[model samples]
Target: MQRGYFFSAEGGEGAGKSSIVSRLSEYLDSRGLEIITSREPGGIAIAEQIRSVILDKENTEMDGRTEALLYAAARRQHYVEKIVPTLNEGKSIICDRFIDSSLAYQGHARGLGIDKVLSINEFAIEDVFPDLTIYLDIDPEVGLRRINENADREINRLDLESLAFHRKVREGYLELVRRFPARIVKINANQKMDEVFEDVKQVFDRFLVSMGKLS
Candidate 1:
């Protein structure tokens, strides 16, 4: 049996990543595909524990390199405990976030250097990479506004970051898209959620067709 495809969604804060992941998962499920959805830094129990430390608003004293390492550690645990097993079962998976988030947030925004962060993640993930990444492109200001207006959304430590920091994160993600055009597809996320989902659906449909999973 063929190993299933691994897809990740990436973006800055409040880019509608969770919503998109949910819609995409449902769409794939309706097509009779065996699939699952997971998130980085918190998919499995161990990783979820790490996620709490990383996102805890009171942990403002966390060093930049330390933050990067924590993320890499969580990723390693998640990959071994959850992701690898799922793919081995021939079941496709959609992850809410993945290594790219590290490269963007810790790498670019934290001034740790993308290449350095990539090396850390390489050791953590052991070369397993996403087959495709759907990036929700949105203006940092607009995205943060959405976050502020959504009272139900959990405000993590990252959400408390300055606008300048979020801007840097978006810049980092855009750089990743430029570096990995074939693996990363950009979707305009400034529009209504329905419109954004349609754009994402088209990209997903084309991918299925290319794999001969659709007519």
Candidate 2:
């Protein structure tokens, strides 16, 4: 039997992860796979409330650790309520963003420390990490500009961070790739949407074949 997979699409702002996730899900669905997709800080009612508190523009006074804790709380709920159940039912779960986001944004960029953030998440998630993490690599300048130009894009608290901060976030992700080379794969996201998704498809094909899901 083909094993169900858990994949998380990750990147800094404007890296087009959300769009890529939609395309990835559609591609997987058409391939006759049972799949469920979700986004962090959400995909559940209680977690969605926590996401609001974290992303609220009015909550400017939120502390870094508080924000980190809130993210972990939401993630725990999402995983237990959505991810685990979906995976148990033998469906692939593709989450838009996951623990890596907290590691990059709150831990590295916000100066809270990556290991600390990871420990918090490890406690929440135990030994369960995504089966694979697809990193969308893009220059922060290009990504930010794309985000600003998109009418459908909504600015969240993280989006309001300084360009330099976003740069740090990118650097953080690169560091993570170095740390977990076996589990994370980086894809150039600066290409045109068509080109990017083509690259994404190739990556998915490779991963599926490797796992005996595709030949």
Candidate 3:
């Protein structure tokens, strides 16, 4: 049986994760490979509802633990409803943001502690982790600046966080990279868009090569 591959794109807000993920998906599709691209807290009806609750501006009183739990809940639903089934059919899955986002944004930035948050997530999906993750590395200030300039984008509560919070989030991701060096690939997102896409393509190519899916 052919093993399925999961590629997760992660970074702070406005780090160009979505754009790069789209490009990567297009590239894979053009190659005539089976691919499924999706985002966390979504990919299914129930998960999208959960995402609304987490992103609602009126939910100011939401507790950190509550937010974490909600994310894990949505993630579980998405995994079961969409991700797992697609993978079982032998398709490559490219997801925008995954456990790392929670580990960095909630655990590190929100002071919840990575291990504590991870514990709940482990329960959520029974420790079904991604096979590969791509970390888009960029300075917090630059990322925030990009968000500010993108007036068409919807600003979330997290977008209002202080620069220090985003910095901590980035640091947390770096720590995760150290912990799972083999599973995570770091890409400098500060480069030009084309260059960033090229970096992502290189990493993905290597993954296919390793699996003997590419020459």
Candidate 4:
């Protein structure tokens, strides 16, 4: 039996993660690969409810710690209810964002302390970690501009944050890359869509070949 693989794409807002994920899913499907795709704070009904609470703009009084804990809770539920089962079934799981987003957004940018946030997440996820993580690298200013140019995007509370916070999120991801050099791969998201797709596909192809999933 082939082993299941988890591929997670992460980056700051407007980093084109969604586009890349969508394209990758299409590419994988075309190759007859069985895969499941999802995003943070969601992918399951219970987790979706939790996502609402976290992203709701009206909840302006939510404490920072409360936010962090809520995310971890949602993640735990999602993993147990959706991700783990899919993997157990021998299908690839591609996630739009995972614990790294929380470690960066809440832990580093929101002043919650990375260690504290990671501890809560450790409890939530135990030893279940992604097999591969792709970090979409982009300039903060350019990313923000893309967000602004796209009007159809939902205005999450986080989207209104100052530039400094987003910068810190990028820095946090860079630090994570340094710490986990082998598992995380960085892709230049600033490139054109076709180029970005090629970079992402190259990484996925390499992993599949190494695992003998591709002949």
Which candidate tops TM-score? 1
Tens digits of per-residue lDDT, candidate 4, 113-176, equal 8888999998999867899999998888988999999999877878878999899999989988
Tens digit of per-residue lDDT, candidate 3, span 77-134: 9988888888888888999998888998889888999999999888877788888899
Candidates 2 and 4 compared: the better one by lDDT is 2
Alpha carbon deviation, residue 30, candidate 2 (Å): 2.3
Per-residue lDDT of candidate 2, residues 1-215 (tens digit): 44578999999999999899999999999877887989997999999999999999888899999999999999999989998888888889999999999999999999999999999999988769998899999999999999889989988888888999999999999999999998899999999988999999998888879877787
List TM-scores for all candidates, in order: 0.99, 0.97, 0.96, 0.95
Residues 66-88 of candidate 1 have per-residue lDDT tens digits of 99999999999999988999999
After aligning candidate 2 to the native by TM-score, how far in Å is the CA of 26 from where it should be?
Answer: 1.2
In terms of lDDT, model 1 sits at: 0.95
lDDT comparison, 2 vs 3, better candidate: 2
Q: In model 3, where is the ten-residue run with the lowest total lDDT?
A: 1-10
The RMSD (Cα, Å) of candidate 4 is 1.3
Superposed model 3: Cα runs more than 4 Å off? none
Residue pairs with backbone atoms closer than 3 Å in model 1 (clashes) = none
**In model 4, which range of ten residues has the least summed lDDT?**
206-215
Q: What lDDT does model 4 reach?
A: 0.89
For every candidate structure, what is the RMSD over all alpha carbons to the true structure, in angstroms?
Answer: 0.6, 1.2, 1.2, 1.3
Which model, 2 or 3, shows the larger TM-score? 2
